[model samples]
Target: MNSLFHDRVRGLNQAPLRPHAQYVLYWSQMNRRVSGNHALAHAISLANSLKLPLLVYEALTCTYRQANRRLHTFILEGVPETAKRLAALGAGYVFYLRARKSDSNNTLYRLAENAAALITDDYPTFIAAQHNSSVPAKLSIPYLAVDSSCVIPMNRFEKREYAAYTIRPKVHRLLPEYLKPWDMPVLRQRWNLPLPAFHTEVTAGNIDALVASCEIDHSVAPSLTFRGGALEAEKRLAVFLDRNLRRYSTDRNHPAAHATSNLSPYLHFGMISALDVALAVERHGLENNLSSAEFLEEMIVRRELAFNFARYAGRQTECLSSLPDWARRTLLAHATDERKPCYSREQFERALTHDDIWNATQKELLLRGKMHGYYRMYWGKKIIEWSPTCQDALETMIYLHDKYALDGRDPNTYTGILWCFGLHDRPWGERSIFGQIRFMSYDGMKRKTDSAAYLREIAWLESTGCEPHPLQ
Candidate 1:
C-alpha cells in the first residue's frame, strides 16, 4: 500500500525539492475549521518534520462563478472564527485576504512566495478543483491536496461506484481503521517567522459592509436565517444529536420535522469535518442502536459514495450524455413523452410552476439554503420531467442547485442530480417522462409522508422571514 501522505496528498507525485521555503502553507479553501481536520493535522505533521511553522491562509475572492448571496454569506460565517481558532493553535500566521477586483492574483502570489509547501482542501467539483490544478503548475514549491470532507476520503475508492450497496461494504470494511478519532496534534515548537498583519477584519459585523462595497450581483441577498460559521455549525450538530438524531430513521423523511442534521452548509464550507460528526454520533452511544446505524449508513456510506463518483468520473456536470449507458438509453426513450404541465427553467426558478408542492420545495431551498433530504430527490426528478429535454433539465437543476443550495456544487449535489438520471440508483418500473430513470412526484411524496404538514411548514418559512431570490 502507498503511504497515506504519498497517495492522499497532492503534488507528491513530483520529485523531492530543496528545502528553501520557510513555512508549510495551508491554503484554506474547502475545509475551514480547526477541529477534526485531517488536512490541518497533516500540515502540522509536515511542518514539524521540517522544523518550520505552519501558515494558514484563506482568500475570499468575488471572482468565482455564480458566487452570490447564499455562497458568500455561508463562506464568510466561518472565516473570522476559523482565523481565531488557528491563532490559538500557535500557527505561525493566519491571514484572510479580501479580494476586490484588483487584488486577487496578488494575494495568491504573496502567499505562494512565503510558503515551503502548499496544502489545500481536495474538492473535485466547482472552481476549487480548477484552483488546485492550476496552482501547482505555476508554483515552485510542492502543492498537496488533502481530503478532509468525506468520512471515507474520496481517494479510498479507485473507481466510480455503481451504487450505495456496492460501496457500503467497502466503506464499512475500512471504518475501523479510518473512522477512529484523530488525535489533535500539539505544535512542538513555534517558528519565529514574522506574522503578516491583516489589513482588514472580515468578521460577521463587516459582512454587509464588504458585500455592499463589492461588485457582486445584488439580486440574491443573503438569507437572514442560515448564516455560516464554526460556532453555528457546532450548535446545529448538538441540536441534531440531542433532539433529532434518535428519531432520524423515522422522522428524517418528514419535511415538516426538523429531524435532519442541518450540517450541509458547514460541510460545504469545511467548517466541520464529516469524521467529527460521525465521532459525535458514535460517542452518543448510537453504535448498537438500529436507528443510529441506519443514520450512519446515510451519513457515511451514501454520502461518501457521492464523493467517490465526482473524484473518479469527470462528467459530473454534463447532461444525460454523462450518465451510464443504461441511464442515457432510458432517458432517450422518454424524450417525447406527453406531459400535462411541462415548465421551462425560468418558470421553475421563479416558482411559477403549477404544482404547489414542487414550488414549495423550491421556495424552501431559496429561503433556507437547504431542503429536506427526501424532498430534494423529488425536487430534482420533477425538474427532469418538466423541462423540454433531459439535457435542459440536468443543466437547469445544476444551475439552480449550485447557485442557491448551501451544499450546492459538492459531490453530493452532483450525485443527487445524477441520481435523477439513474446514477447510483436502481431502475424503477417503466414510466413516461423518466423512463427507467427514478420517478418522484407529488403522489409518491404524499404517500411517503405528511404532504400537508410539509406544505404548511414551507408556507410559514416563506411568509415570515427573508424573501427567496435566485442567485443572479
Candidate 2:
C-alpha cells in the first residue's frame, strides 16, 4: 500500500487475505467516482500485490429510509460515467439495482466469495456507515474501508473536534502533505472475469425509467438544478472556478448571487472527491492571483470538522444528546418556552410558514435539492423558532433533509442542522426560544442579504422549474 494512503486504509476485520481468490473487490458504497479515489487506488494496490484483477461493485437498493425518486435518480445518473471510467482502468464493474424488496440482496456476498480482500468506503453517515459496521463481520475475506471522502482522512484526528477553529489549523498544517493530485496506479491484471447475472445496465437514456421502476417514494422528484455523475460534478467545479471563485469570498453568503459552489450534493454523494476539488481550487487560485482561503475554509476545514464530529459521535450524530453542554443546558432551559405559532412537520415540509424567507428557503430545498449555505442557517433557526420543542425542531430538520435535500443525511447535514441547535457552536447572549443558542430573525436576513432577489429567483424556479441563471 502507498504510504500516502496508509492512514486512509483500515482493515475492519481480521480475516486474512484469501490465498486462491480470483479478484480484489472494491465496493463502491459512498465514494462512487474513479478519479481522486483513495479507496479505489488502495484496491488496485492490493490487486497488484496479489497479482489479481479488481472488480468494482456498486449498488442502489430501495431499502434505505426515504428511498425516493430524487435520491435514486441522482445516484443512477452517475452510473454510465462510472462504468466508462472503470472499464478504461481495466477493472470490472458490477452495478446492482435492487428495485424491490423481493430482489436478491446477496449480490455483495456472492461477489465476495471469490475475492482476495473486500475494500469499501469509510463514510460515517447514512447506509454506508451501517454497512461498514455490519458487513465486515459477515464476510469470510478481509474487510477494509478507505476514507476517500475527506481531503485529510478522518483517522488523523484522534477525537471529535468541537468546532472549525480547532480543526482549521490542523487541516491547514497537513494540507501540503495530502493536497496533491492523486497519481492513479496502473492495474497489473485486467478484469477478465464475467459479471454477475444481477448486474443492471445503466445509461443516460434509461435513468428515468430505472428510477421509476424502483419501489421508492415517487412524489419527491429529482433535483431540477443539479444532475449527478463525475462529469457533472467536474463541470460544476469548472463553473465555480471560472465564474464564481472570484466572487465567492464577497458573495457566497448571498443566495441570489449564485457565487457558492453548489457542489454539496456532489460532495455528499461522492461523485467528486474533496481532495480533487480542493486541489483544483488551490491551483486555480494560485494561477489567477485570487484568494481561495474562504472557500478552502468551508470545503476543507468546516467540512472535515463535520466528518470528525460524525466519526466520534457515532449513532448519536443526529440526536440532540450529541450537543455540547452549554447547548443542551440552554435548549433544555427554554424547552417549555411557548412558540408563538407552532407548525407541524408536514406544514414545514409544505413550505407554509408565515415567513417569506423561510418558505423560500424550503422551496429552494424542494426545487434545487439544496439551499444556500448562508441562508440554511436562517432556515434552521426559523425551524427552531416555529417548532413546539427543540427536539421537535431537530427531528423536523433531519426528516426534511433526509427526505428532500440532495445534501441531506451527510455529516454536514447533521452538523449544520445541529448547529442550528448549537452543536459545535458557542453560546450567545440570552434569547427567548433559543435560550443562549444563536438566533436569526427575518429582519436580520432581510437586512444582511439580498432577500428580494433570492425570492424572485426561487419564485422563478417554483413557477418554471428552470434555473434563471445559466451557470446555476
Q: What TM-score would each prediction reach against the true structure?
A: 0.93, 0.99
Number of clashes in every candidate structure?
A: 1, 0
Q: What is the C-alpha RMSD of each candidate to the true structure, in Å?
A: 3.3, 0.8
Residue 204 in model 2: lDDT: 96
Estimate, for each residue in 269-333, the C-alpha lDDT of model 1 and write its tens digit: 88888888988888784554535686788889988888888777775444455588888888888
- Relative to the true structure, candidate 2 reaches a TM of 0.99
Candidate 2, residue 23: Cα displacement in angstroms equals 0.4
lDDT, candidates in the order shown:
0.77, 0.93
Once fitted onto the true fold, the runs of candidate 1 whose alpha carbons sit more than 4 angstroms away are: 1-7, 12-15, 191-199, 286-290, 315-317, 466-472
Best by TM-score: 2
Q: Which ten residues in a row have the lowest lDDT in candidate 1?
A: 463-472
Task: Please report the candidate that would top lDDT against the real structure.
Answer: 2
